[model samples]
Target chain A: MMTTPSSITSNELNFLVYRYLQESGFTHAAFALGYEAGINKTSIDGNLIPPGALITFVQKGLHYVELEANLESEKFDGDDDFSFLQPLDLITKDVSELQ
Target chain B: MMTTPSSITSNELNFLVYRYLQESGFTHAAFALGYEAGINKTSIDGNLIPPGALITFVQKGLHYVELEANLESEKFDGDDDFSFLQPLDLITKDVSELQ
Candidate 1:
């Protein structure tokens, strides 16, 4: 069996934390960490994503997946991409509007 | 007070999980999450970091900070960067060799 690497570096760990914050849409937390760690290019498109943006982005993705699943294979375009280039619609709506 | 955002997206949550696993040096777990999420550029410098790496990394970083604190202010150049550009020395050694 292959043995695990005996050491891990701080840079690697910091990078992981950086990526995590960015992914979670914990914009404030991610920025705080990146600033402390002195890492460059830490933003997700240079925008401070709101806390709930991630959940909205995901629900919308699942909606699209379910929609695509209902379509016949022939009707589904294999080359079609479902990438969301912009923030979700929910992000644009106000909290009062959501209520 | 400003109201919090009304929704959080799934993509954001997935990113957070991926980041957590990666940051913790759970290489296998991080890859699994990344694969399921269809995220690209997920690896830390294209290598699978072993478990226990994050702990070691942090310990080493603390060692540096402590060392720096012991040095006199004038002796410690303000412009000096403490960046660790390569994997820590511990990583290069084998587990048995470490003992």
Candidate 2:
């Protein structure tokens, strides 16, 4: 199981999401999210972050969560059974419910 | 409609995919893809890419394709109707079929 980097703060994630929404042409959504998330206060370099970064980070995070769940159940066979599972289910459901 | 950067070569994309497969723990798949795509010969700096770069790039590309399709039909009201469409469907079907 991979450990998440402690360096990645919530603000960075929020900024990324805000940028993604703007890039995808969700101006109203982006503006709302930016306001709620306080993205204007972030000091992140927008140019350094490539487009789709938020989606990529979310996908990787989901995979890590699935991997952790598999390990805890002693079913860590390295098979990617949870690869197709949607992110929302994992986020909303208890970890035990996944197994 | 946004124009995809001409600087993004197919080799760069292949390398990103290769790195993504490796990061996701699909070792055998990564090896096969690397060999087929000649990723070993690519000079891309691995450190520059954050995890999930490939997924991010693909999502952006899919968005662009959807945007272009909407534009051609003169229905480019900035409404994101095709936001939920899967990447495979766009890749396999004709652009006209999407509408």
Candidate 3:
């Protein structure tokens, strides 16, 4: 019954990815991504987010989307057959397509 | 060049997943998964793992696999066109298959 927050902007997501890359020690990759995404322009404080937050949020979002899809289709019988989603698929695909 | 630790066992992974579910407030799901995975029998100290550790480890592992793929194929020319893998895919698929 967890709901995905509607307020998260693409910029925020980009920042999170940037921070995640940095925290994970992917310095070159982080630099490239941050430069392309203009992460420096964002005002969000990087310190506020703990390490591993991006993946955590994405995982939770995927779960919520799956739950929503199951609920809408009336297929959630507690069978625990939830299909795990790729992070990009969860972000890009429609909920109906996921089901 | 972070190498995936060979020391991590399936029991450790299961424990991490259980902890993740519990930390995310999916109490019933956590209980079910814990029961099925025999999480209580594991000696891993749950308190030592921070929130989001499971997803973080999985994400890092995926990245390492991707990097290894690129290196082995000699296709890594500093271009950042890495394909993101599903968490389950990372866990289930062999490295060669991922590429």
Candidate 4:
């Protein structure tokens, strides 16, 4: 079965969610985490990477690192409603911390 | 005790997070919940409302509703890293749903 993509985008809404995260304060938590992937391994540097992908940081940016060789590459194109489950189901393997 | 407010806002980052949620498919989950607050109670309508505030939907919009009368009035404002803690902490009382 296939679901059609519904077009939903707004500059205002985008600003709101980002501002929500900024107020909550979990931006630098990537390196603080220890995953089966790697404690030293990172991919999200305040940039919301796709789930199961390594979220790492650099001096200049917050980037998403995908280790395709070590990871199961599922065909998920673009960020859409399917992403709601990613942080919990796919991204953050360490659930207790997110709680 | 207080932390200084830092200025961090970006059009690109904001769009990224919003697109992430769209891919995950949680936009319409607001009214489907049963909370101690109220099963009929709704505040979030695809739009990310601030924690502890009521998020409601209307015919034309996704809006945030604040009920100061029945809720504890916390003095913190704006969305930040503080928001990363919201979905699991303040907004979602039903831990099982989020977990």
Candidate 2 vs candidate 4: the lDDT winner is 2
Report how far off residue A55 is in candidate 4 (Å). 11
Q: Tens digit of lDDT per residue, candidate 2, span A1-99?
A: 222112334455456545655665555545555555567877666666667655554444445444445555556455544433344343334456666
Give candidate 1's fnat, 2 decimals: 0.04
Q: Please give the DockQ score of every candidate, comma-separated.
A: 0.04, 0.02, 0.02, 0.03
Pairs in clash, predicted candidate 2: none
Could you say which candidate leads in TM-score?
Answer: 2
Q: Model 1, range A41-76, lDDT digits (tens) per residue?
A: 432232332333323323333332222232322244
Which of 1 and 4 is ahead in TM-score?
A: 1
DockQ metric, candidate 1: 0.04
Residue range with the least summed lDDT across 10 consecutive positions in model 3 chain A: A1-10
lDDT of 3 at B7: 37
lDDT of 3 by residue, A1-99 (tens): 321122344455556655655665555545555655677888776665557655554444444444445555556355445455543343335567666
Which of the two candidates, 2 or 3, achieves a greater lDDT against the reference?
A: 3
What lDDT does the true structure give each of the candidates? Answer: 0.39, 0.51, 0.52, 0.23
Position A43, candidate 2: lDDT? 68
lDDT of 1 by residue, B1-99 (tens): 112232334554454445555665556546655665655644222233333333432443333222223232225455343333222332232223222
After superposition on all C-alphas, the RMSD of every candidate to the true structure, in Å, is 20.8, 19.5, 18.8, 22.6
| TM-scores for the candidates | 0.24, 0.40, 0.39, 0.17
For residues B1-99, write the lDDT of model 4, one tens digit per residue: 111121112322232333344343433221111221132333223333222111111101110111111122233333222111221121222222222
